[model samples]
Target: MGMPASPAHDTVDPGEGLMKKQIRTTLILTLDDATMSSFVPLLQKGVQVKAQLGRSMKHLLCEQYGVNPEYLTERIQTIFLDGKVVDNVETTTVKGGAIIALSAAMPGLAGATLRTGGLLAAFRDGLTHEEDLEAVDSHELGMVTVKLFNLLVRELGPVLLEKGVWVTREDAESLVKRWADTPLRAIDHVEMDGLKVSLEELAGLDWSGDSEYLLLRAVG
Candidate 1:
């Protein structure tokens, strides 16, 4: 008897692969009370803010963004600058294009060790971020990306979104596509370049892939 045919090789469908890739690039951010609960867990995207780079992180937060100094010290328990945990938020310089992620207290050993000035902070000394003292010319209008995780999302996300955040058109388009199908009754309307558009129209437009950025705000 002929040998049994070898098992078929697993192959990814082209259309399915494209769809998955698109999904990966898409981001959905929400500000509505009903959606905030669901969106908090899912909001891992960045918000861009124009800033004078080479300023201390604390200055950016407390002075520029109007984040209460006491709240920054007491409420925001964890800080990460470009992936590594940061301890001295006041001294750490925020450069243009840098990503700063903020979070409240987290559970477990890793969280404890990584938290700024936590009892276990010594454990993460090798992985912590250290700032350079050398000064650099600050840009008049430079973009810095900020990410809010966990409680930070609930606490700070709406304020920043309402104040307005800069996002690339490509990213905005991707966001529109991701939320197109969801029953987003919370979204008052969609705006592109200050013109109101329906969700379907927003998703259908071919975004200019240039350096133009959109001022995104979530209205109640």
Candidate 2:
């Protein structure tokens, strides 16, 4: 699958891109409730998950990930597949290299208009996501980006972290800064692969090269 690696170079953006064909570098951390709160906001930036390319957003969440349909409908108020706003989840298929962003209702008219099948969908016109008419259906394994915002960060971020998600090099650098403010020693636990690792060691990591992922798992 074609995935564009995030910014390890001058060219890429902080979020919304595919990870390069990767390194299985995983760092699992267990933290106290207070410390874990620090990581929840990262979901708004975006995290990577492996998925079948042709599934619809409804199946991707409800069927593949076992998210409650009612919760998805009631709690998730705005949806973006890649960067476009979505008015329909059932018909719009997520492709390889796609990013899916979820949020509770945003404030003001932007929320009313951007919400899925909301009363103001007509106002969005061509801005809404549409299914590809000639696209081939594929069961291909690929990485997909999922970003959670507002309340969904607390509601859904942990679920993705528990399963493990890929973070960019930029996220790693930000993590170092966060850890500096709040020491890694304060974290409940941490492991790289299966071995315990200190936040200092993680902070000391040579982030200079192209091994652009830090597969982070949260166990609390």
Best by lDDT: 2
Error of 1 at 115 (Å): 1.0
lDDT of 2 by residue, 14-55 (tens): 121122222247676766556667876678888898887787
Which candidate number has the best TM-score? 2
Candidate 1 overall Cα lDDT vs. reference? Answer: 0.67
**What TM-score do all the candidates reach, one by one?**
0.74, 0.81
Off by over 4 Å in 2: 1-24, 183-186, 208-210
TM-score of 2: 0.81
TM-score of 1: 0.74
Q: Candidate 1, after superposition: displacement of residue 34 in Å?
A: 2.8
Q: Rate residue 187 of model 1 by lDDT.
A: 57
Candidate 1 structure quality by residue, lDDT tens digits, 1-220:
0112222333333332232222121222333566444435334587787777988888888888778889999988898888888888777888878888898888999888988878887788577887786856464568888888877887786666655677777666766776677876665444444334456655666665445676665534
> In model 2, which residue pairs have backbone atoms overlapping below 3 Å?
4-18
Clashing pairs in 1: none
